[model samples]
Target chain A: MKRLREVFLSALMLENPLMRLMIGLCSALAISTRVESTLFMGMAATFVLVCSNTIISLSRKVIPDEVRIPVFIVVIASFVTIVDLVMRAYFPPIYARLGVWIPLIVVNCIILGRAEAFASKNDVLASVADGLGMGGGYTIVLLIMGTFRELVGTGKIVMFERTLVSLGSTFQPPTIVVLFPGAFFTFGFLMAILNKLENRWWGK
Target chain B: MMEAARTYLLLFFGAAIVYNILLIRFIGLCPFFGVSKSIETSIGMSVAVLFVMTVATSACWLLWGLVLQPLGVGEFLYIPSFILVIAALVQFEEMFIRKVSPPLYKAMGIYLPLITTNCAVLAVAVESVKPGFLKLNIPYHYSLPEAVVYAIGVACGFAVAIVMFAAIRERIELAPIAKSLRGAPIGFITAGLMSLAFMGFAGLFKL
Candidate 1:
């Protein structure tokens, strides 16, 4: 239990996929323009990551060394396709907004990286903890970014067509905050703050 | 004949400049920052992507058209099948290069395998077949050659953006930048500026 806790906690902060490792920034930046879509994308990615990590951990012993990468890709890609089709069938708007990004999750290094690094070496339960923690960390960062972008860019945060938060129409929202440059700007500042906090707390 | 040439030209410039895979579209950014520290590695990665993307896109196109379309399972199986094809293609290219061109394989190092996961390559593979995305003033499905050409254009676009960014970043390394902004923060800012510059070319291929 302690080991599981450690694994989960480490993924949340110490080994945060986006903030620390920077393995999965592409989708994080692209889909984060809207808070709702970001949440959906995060959940979809977490589901895939958790399922793939568990399966990979379970079958790690039986899988051949030569084709392990391909095996991991197959597992990850299948989950992503499931998410893609389900989203298309159920949540067409978010799926359309996400566009190619939903399918592109197959190449997301975080999933493959965890499968190769942690899952392949660890037990199934430990891998599950790691997957959940990492997925949670990813989702947290996405929500933070999405909040900033949605609030600043459009003066409000709307999820499922409902306004969760709004700064009023009189507030002049800078449209740039939701564009590509704004993503870079927001990511850089957040990363710097995270870096400073880590340094202060851990004394690098 | 003249119409085809114009379309190809428009496609090349459109992909390369207007919608650069790296800066503008935000695909293939992992290596864009990771391996783009030096011009040499940038060039090497660019070439590797160029070769792999062309072959992978063509193979994916053919697979989609011939196998997936016939089986009527293209919708469900595309992600896995395309990924498998890319992985297999990378493996084949690795073996072929090791046997046929040892030095080149040694030079490419890790970027070759990394191509399998580069979203830009996969994006090209998926987009080139989408009827709406690939309409190069042609109102139909992309032919094999057209798909291959567009892939080459996108790869070239990636190459151009990365090489340019590398050159700028090399200079940036010399400049006395601030503490926190030295590495990736500055890199992101620089890329943002470059992206803005690319936005200037957005109206180039306007129909």
Candidate 2:
């Protein structure tokens, strides 16, 4: 239990897939314009990660060394296909907004990276914990970025067509915060903040 | 002939600049940051991407039209099939390049394997075949010529963004930046600024 917690915590903070590892930025940045989409994207990615990690961990022994990469990709891609079909059927709006990004998740380096680095070598339980932690960390960062962009860019936060937070009309918002470049700027500053916090606390 | 030439030109510029796969669409960012540390390496990466993206997209395009669509499993199977196509292409390209040109292989060989996971290649492949995927104001269901041209344009856009960013990063290395923000953070910030500049190119050409 403690080992699982350690693995989870390390993935959550010390080795965050987005902020620290920086493996999966493309979809994170693109879908982070709204909290709702980010939440859904996060959930989908976590589902794929956990499932693939578990399957890969169980079958790690049978998979040949020379063919592991392709095997890993096939595993990841199958999961992504599941997410894609489900989203297209149930969440048409998000599926539309996310568009090609949904399919692109197969190539997301985070899933492949973890599969090769952790799941292949670790047990199924640890792999599940790592996947949850990494997915949680990724979702957290996306939420932070999404909230910041939506709040600042529009001066309000709305999810599911409901206004969750509003700054009122007195405040002016910078439209750029919601655009493509804003993603880069927001991610850059947030990562810097995370770096500062890590350095101060860990003394590294 | 003039009309066809003009359409191709518009498609190229539209993909390469107005809707850049890297800066604007935000695909293939892993390599955008990973390879842009040095201009030389970025150039190598750029060449590898250009080669692989064009070839891979063409192959996937053919596969989609020939195999997946005919089998009626394209909607569900495209993700896996496209990925497999890209992974296989990258491997084949590595071996083929090594035998054909040693110097070229040395320049681009290492980056080939990495391209297997670069989302831009897959994104381009899917977008080319699927109509309305990009929202680029162009009609979809691209013919082979159009798809190849669009792939090349997207690759060129990626190359332009990464190579230019690499040049800037080479200079940024000399500047005194905060320790925390010195590396990837600052790179993102720089890309943000560059992306803002790219936005200015919007409406310059409407296809």
Candidate 3:
């Protein structure tokens, strides 16, 4: 239980994936263009990561050394495909918005990198903790990015599918927030803010 | 055929310039972020990726268009087939480049192998396999050489972006910046800025 708390907490701030490791910025930058898509993408990635990490850790000892990477990849790829098909079927709107990013998860580097770096070496439970932590970290970053982009770019907080979490009815969302450059500028501001807080607290 | 060829060229160039599979489109970024620390290495890895992408695209195209598309398995076979083809092509390219281009092999180092996992190549494979994927003025019909050309052009565009950014970055290292944003922080900013600059060429060319 304590380990789980540590895992979630670490992923939240102490070892944030984007700001600290810089492992998976590709999807971070691209999918963060919209709030709904970012949340969907983040949750999907977290699901894949958690499952794959558990499976990899479980099979680590039995898997032969020669085919280890191949095994990990097959596991990861299967999950990605699973997510892709499921999204295409149920979340067609999101599936379309995500487009190549859905498939791009296979090469996310974070998933594969984690499978090899952590899962393959760690125990099942610890790997689960790590996966949960990392995925949580990833999701947190995405949510933050998504919230910023959505609020500033369009000036409306469209959450999930139907809910309009807009600040005020009169508020018109900044259209630039939905565009490409908005993703960057928003990310820059967030990064600056995160850095300032981190430095103030952590003394970086 | 000419129009079709031009379309592939358009996709190839489009993915490179406008969409930019690397910095902009967010594909093939592992290499872009990992190996692009130095200009010489970025050029080498870009060439390596360019070669592998061109070959892998054609190989997967044949596999999909001829084998999968006819059997109606084209839709579902993308991820599996692409992963297989890219992995195989990366291996074969690694061996071939090591043999024929020793100096090049030495420069790229391990990134040559990592290209198999690069999302950019995977993106090319996925896009090339899509039903009615358009290039420029022509309606894209999946063919052998066309796939290869499109892949090469896209990779070249990536090569253009990374190589250019890499050169700038190398020079920028000498420029004065605040202490907080020196290395990696500035690198990310630089990538963001370069991507912004690439936006200016949005409607420059049709293909």
Clashing pairs in 3: A153-A174, A153-A177, A154-A173, A154-A174, A155-A173, A155-A174, B7-B136, B28-B120
Write candidate 1's Cα lDDT for A1-204 as tens digits: 999999999999889999789898889987889989889989998999999999999999999999899999999998998899899999988877788898899999899999999999999999999999999999999999999999999999888889989999799999888877788778888877776776688787
Per-residue CA lDDT of model 3 for B66-122, tens digit only, reads: 788799866666787688778877888889988998988888887787786788888
True contacts kept of 2: 0.95
lDDT of each: 0.86, 0.91, 0.77
Measured with C-alpha atoms, the lDDT of residue A106 in candidate 2 is 93
Fnat for model 1 comes to 0.57
All candidates in order of DockQ, best leading: 2, 1, 3
Over B18-73, each residue of candidate 2 has an lDDT whose tens digit, in order, gives 99988998999988888787888788788788888999889999999999999999
| Model 1 interface CAPRI class | medium
Q: Give Cα distance to truth, residue A146, candidate 3, Å.
A: 1.1
Instruction: Evaluate model 3: give its lDDT.
Output: 0.77
> B60-170, model 1: which lDDT tens digit per residue?
999999899899998889899998888888888788778987776777777778888999889889887755333433435778887888899889999998999999999
Say which prediction, candidate 2 or candidate 3, comes out ahead on TM-score.
2
Give candidate 2's TM-score.
Answer: 0.97
Q: Give the DockQ (C-alpha) for candidate 1.
A: 0.63
lDDT by residue (A55-93, candidate 3, tens digit) is: 999989899998777777778888988998899899987
Error of 2 at A35 (Å): 0.7
